[model samples]
Target: MKINFTHKLKILHPFFYVVALCFLSTKAEEDNTDLRFATQPTHQTAVLGSTVVLPCRVIPRDGTVQWTRDGFGLGTIRRLDGFDRYSMIGSNEEGDFSLKISPVTLEDDSEYQCQVSSKKGPKLRSRVARLTVFVPPESPSISPSPEVSATAGVNVTIKCESIGGRPAPELSLRFL
Candidate 1:
C-alpha cells in the first residue's frame, strides 16, 4: 500500500504540529529562566587606601549567601550600617552581593569569590576584584643634554625612579 504526500500529511499533521508546539514553548520558557551570577570582576584599577565597592549580584534564585576573600569567610552577621575598613554591604535576597573595601592596602590585593547556597546545590560563584596600591614615583631630574644638542643617531639616557611604598613602585616612560 502506497500513501500519497497529501494523504500522509493529513494523518501526521496534527501530531507533528503538537510536537513542534511543545518544543517551541519549552525552549521559550527555558530562555526566560534567570541567569546564574557569573563571577566577573569589574574593578580594574584602584589606588591604595581608597574605598572601593565590588558587586557580586546573583540573578538566579538562591537560599544562603556569603562573601569570601581568597576562600575566606566575610562573616554572616549583617553589618551594613557599621563603619569599618572592610564591610559587607547590601542584601542577599536582593541579589546585591557586593563587598566594600576602605583604605585598601597591599595585603588586600587578591581575588575574592562570592558564593550562594541553595537547597538545589551550593554554587561557588566567584569574582576576582583586585586592589592596586599606587604610589607616585619620586621627582625626576633631566640632565641638560650636555651641549643642549644631540644628533638623532646619538644615545641619550633618561632615568625615572620611585624609592618609596611597601611594594617597590612601578615606573613608566614616554618620550615627548
Candidate 2:
C-alpha cells in the first residue's frame, strides 16, 4: 500500500489553521482586559484613633474608578458608609486613589476591594486590600505605688497596670 503526498498535505492543512485561529482569539481577549489595580502598604495595619492610607494604582485609564470596602460600594473614601473614621487622602488621574482612615478602631479591620471600570465591558479591574487594626500595647504602669522596696532575696510584688488592650503583659521579675 502507498499514500498520496497531496492527500496527506490536505489532511494536515486544516488542523494547523485551526490551531492558529485559536491562539489569535485568546490574545485578543487578554488585551481587551488589561486594566489592573495594585496597592501600597499591602498589609494595612494601624492603631486605634490613628490614620492609615490605602493606596490604589491602576494601568491604562479608560473610564472612572471607584473605591469600595470589602466589596461594598464606596463612592469615595471620604463619603463611604460606616466611614466615620475614614476619608480620602489622595487621588489623581494617574490611577492613584488612596483611602485614608482617621481615628481607626479595632472594629475597622476587614478585607477591602478597589474597583476600576471602563465604558467598554471588557475593561473592569478590581484589587483587594486587607486592613488590620491593632491596638498598640498601653504604657506599662506600676501598681501598689510606682516604686517598690525589697530586701535581699526577699519576695516582693511589683505590679504593672494596663488598659484598653489585649495580650496580657509578661511580668518579668528583675531587681534594679
Candidate 3:
C-alpha cells in the first residue's frame, strides 16, 4: 500500500517544528553566557571615618546590580534607605556596580556581595567580600607614671596598656 505524500508531510511537520524549537532554545541559552561578572568585589579594610568602595562589574552590562550586607539586600543600584553613608558608584552603562560608603563607621563592617539579576539567566552572585573597620586606640598609659629610680644593675617591671581599640593594639616599649 502507498501512503499519500501530503499525509506523510503533515505527520513530519510537527516533528520538524519541535526539533527546530529545541535548537533555537539551546542557542538562546548559549548567547546568555556573556552575561557574567567581569570583576568581583574583594576583601577590604577601611579606617573609621573614611571612605571605601567594593568593586563589581558585569561583562555584558545588561541587568540590575544590587548590594547585600551579611546576606541581606541593601538596595538596587542606589543608596540604601536608612543608611546615609551607603551609595552606589560607577556607571551602570559600564557594568560597574561598586558600593561606596563614605565616612565608614564601625557598624559598616560586614560581609558584602554583589548580585546581578537579568532576563537572560538565573541571578548571579559574586564571591563574598569582608569589610573591616579599624578603630584607633586611646592614649596609652604606663605604670610608674612620675618616675622609677632603681639601684645599679637592678631589674624593674613596667606595664603599658591601651584601651578601646578594635582588633587590639600592639604595644611596644622603648627605654630612654
Q: Highest TM-score among the candidates is held by which one?
A: 3
CA error at residue 5 for candidate 3, angstroms: 8.9
Which pairs, if any, clash in model 1? none
Model 2: per-residue lDDT, tens digit, 1-176?
78799999999999989999999998788657566665533666777788888776766555666666666776743456666666555556666766777778776687776666665555454556688877767777786777787788998777776665633555555556
Q: On TM-score, who's better, 2 or 3? A: 3
TM-scores for candidates 1 onward, in order: 0.55, 0.65, 0.80
Report the Cα lDDT for residue 152, model 2.
84
TM-score of 1: 0.55
Q: Tell me how candidate 2 scores on lDDT.
A: 0.67
Model 1 is weakest, by summed lDDT over 10 consecutive residues, at 140-149
RMSD of 1: 9.1
User: In terms of TM-score, which candidate is stronger, 1 or 2?
Assistant: 2
Please list the C-alpha lDDT of all candidates, in the order they appear: 0.65, 0.67, 0.88
Candidate 1 per-residue lDDT, tens place, 93-159, comes to 6667677788777677777666776545545466566655565546544455323455799996765
TM-score of 3: 0.80
Worst 10 residues of 3 by lDDT: 143-152
Write one digit per residue (lDDT tens) for candidate 3, span 1-176: 99999999999999999999999999987766668888899999998999999999888887678899999998884767877899888887888888999999999899999998876788899999999999999989988873667778999888889998887999998766
